[model samples]
Target: MSRTELLRLVFAQIFLHATMTGLRLAAPLLALSKGYSAGAVGALIALFALSQIFLAIPAGKYADHHGVRRPMGFAVLAAAVALVLATAFPTIPVLCLGAMLTGAAAGITVIVLQRHIGRAATSNAQRKQFFSWLAIAPAISNFIGPFGAGLIIDHAGQASGDLLAYRICFAVLAVLPLLTWLLVMRVRELPFEPYDPKAAPTHAWDLLKSANFRYILFVNWLQSASWDIHSFLVPILGYERGLSASTIGTILGAFALAAALIRMALPVIAARYSEKRVIAASCIITVGVFAIYPMVSHAAEMVVCAIVLGASLGCVQPMVMSLLTQVTPAHRQGEALGIRLMFINASSFLMPMVAGSFGALIGVGAVFWVVASIVAVGTPVVGKIQLRDNEMPPEKNL
Candidate 1:
C-alpha cells in the first residue's frame, strides 16, 4: 500500500469503527425509548447476529472469489441504508431488520479488510504492525463512541426527543462509509489467483476439521463472550448500582481508554512473547482482573480494575489475528477467518442477553462473577493451538 493509501485506510477504518461503536451505544437506548423491556434489548442484540452467523461463509467466499474492494463498498452502502431504515421507522421489527442487515454487511467487511491487511503486509513484523494500527480503529470508537452517544441522548432526553439524537448519530455514521467508499476507490487491487472450483474445498465445512483452528476459534468465542458481558452489561449494571448516567459513561470511557493503550503496546508485547504465550498470558491476566471485580467497593478502585481488565483483554484479538495468518493458507484466509468469526459473533451475540437475564433473575453482581468464570475456562485451552503444516514460527523481534 502506498503512503497515501495507507493513510486513507487508516482514516476510513477510524470513521467506520467509530460509527459502529456509536450505533452500538445507541441501540439499547433507542430500544428502551420505544418501550422495549430488558428482554427486548437482548433480542435486539441477538437479532443482529442471526444473519451474521448464517451468512459469514458465503460473504467470505464472495470476497475471495471477487476482490475485497467491491464487497466492502457494497457492505458500506448497505450499512448506510440500514441506518436510515433504523432511524426512519423505529420499531422492534424494523430495528431487527436494520441490525440484521448491518451485521451481515459487517461480516463481509471484516474478512475483506483482514485479507487486505494480510496481503498488504510483507512480513510477520509488518503484519503485526499493520494489525496493531488496525486495532486503533476499535480503540478510538470504544473510547469516543459511547460518550458521543451519551452526549446525544443527554441532549435529547431518552423519553421525549431522543429519536432525533439517534437520527443524528446514524446520519453522522453514514458519512464514514461514504468516505470509505471514496478512499478505497483509488487503491490498486491485490492480485489473486483464480478461484478454481476443483481446487477449492467443496464446502466451508472442511475448514472446521482442523483441531488447532477449532481450539483457537473457541478461544475467540470465549474471549468475546467475556468482553460482551462487559460491553452490554456495564451500562445496565452501573445504572442498577446507583451510578449516574454520566458516571457510568465515565467508567466506560476509562475502560476503553485503557484498552486503546493496551492495543497500542501490543506490537511491542508481541515482539517479546511468542504469539501463543501472549494470548495465554493475556487471558490469565484478564481472568484475574475480572475475578477481582466482585470484591471492589470504591468507584475509583472499580475504575482501576476496569482499566486492568481492558489492558489485558484488548491484546488478544491482534495476537489472534497474527496467529490466524500463520495457521491458515493464503487462499483459505477468508474461509478460516469467517469460520472463526462465526463462533466469535455467536458468543458476542448470545452471551450478553444471557448475562442480562441472569442479572435480572439473580443480581447484577453475579454478571461479573459469571463472566470471570467464563474467561478462566480459556486459559487451559489456549495452549492447544499450533500453526499449520507449512507455517513458520513467529520471527524473533524482541
Candidate 2:
C-alpha cells in the first residue's frame, strides 16, 4: 500500500471507532432519558456485550473465509444502518436493537483490523507500531465520543422538546462506516494457504489443551472482565457517590484520556521489554487498582485510581495480540484469533450480568471487590506464558 493509503486507512479507522464509541457511551443515557428504569438501561447496555459472546468467532471465521475487507465492510455498514435506525425511531426496543447490531459489527471490525494489520506491516517494528496505533484509535474515540455525545444531548435537551441531540449523534455515527468501507477497499489482500476440506474444525477445547494457549485466552478473558467492570460500574458508582452528571462525565473522559496516552506509549514499552513482561506487569497493576478502588471515597482519589487503571489495562490487549500471533501456526492464525476473541467476548457478556447482580444486591460498590479478585487471579497465570524460541518469528528477535 502507498503511504497515503496507509494514512487514509488510519484516519478511516479513527472515524469508525469514534462513532462506535459514541453510540456505546450514549446508549445508557439515551435509555435513561427515554424513561427506562436503571435495570432496563443496564440490560440495553449489556445487550452490546452479550451479542459478542457468540458473534465473535463467527465473525472471525467469516473474515477468514472471505477476505477481511468484505466482513470489515459489512460490519461498518451494519453499524451505520443500526445507528441510523435508532435515530429515526428512538424507542427502547429499537435502541436495544441498535446497540446489539453495533456490538456485533464492532466485534467483526476488531478481527478484520487485526487480520489486515497482521498482513499489511512488513516488519516486527512496523507491526508493533501498527498495533499501538490500533490501540490509540479506540482510546481517542472513547474519550471524544462520549464527551461529544454529552454536549450534544445537554444542549438539545435544553433547546428542544425532542432528544434530538443524541439522534444527531447517531446520525453522524451512521456516516463513519462508509468511510471505513471505502478505505478498506484499497487494502491489498494478504496471502493465505487454503483450509483443507477434510480437516476437522478447531475446537476451543483443543485450543485450550495447550497450557500456554489457555493462559493466553485466560489473560484475554480477565482483561475483558476488568474492562467490563469499570465501564459498566463506574457510572453507577458515580451516581451513588452523588456526583453531578457532568462531573461523572468528566471523570470518565479523564479515564479514557489516560487509556489513550498509555496506548500511545505501548510501542515504546514493547520495544524495550518482551510483550509477556508487559502483560504480567500490567496485570499486577490492574490487581492493585481494582482492589483499592472500592475503598476510595473522593472523586480526586477515584480519578488518580482511574489513571493507573487506564495505564495498566490499556497495554494488555495489544500485547496479548502480539503474543498470540507468535504462538499459533501461520496457517491457523485466523481461527486461533477467532477462538481468543470469543473468550474475550464471552467474558464481556457474562461479567456485566455477574457484576450487575453484585451491584444490585450488595450495592454498586461491591463490584470493585468482585472485579479485583478476577484480575488478581490472573497475575500468576500471566507469568506462565512462554514464547518458545521456535515459535518466535525471526524478525521479532532483532
Go through the candidates in order and give each one's C-alpha lDDT. 0.72, 0.74
Question: Best candidate, TM-score-wise?
Answer: 2
User: Using Cα atoms with residue i matched to residue i, what is each candidate's TM-score against the true structure?
Assistant: 0.83, 0.85
Model 2 gets an lDDT of 0.74
Across residues 1-398, which tens digit of lDDT does each residue of candidate 2 receive? 45676566666677777676778778888777767899788678778766777777776666666766778778887788898898898777787888888877877777777766755666555666677767777676666767777777777768864578778777877887888888788777777655567967755345555667778888878877887789778888888888888877777767777887888888798677777788888888887888887787788888888888877888888877776666665545566677877777677767777888888888776678766777787678878887663244332222
**Model 1 TM-score, all chains together:** 0.83
Residue 305 of model 2: what lDDT? 85
Q: For model 1, how many clashes?
A: 0
The candidate that wins on lDDT is 2
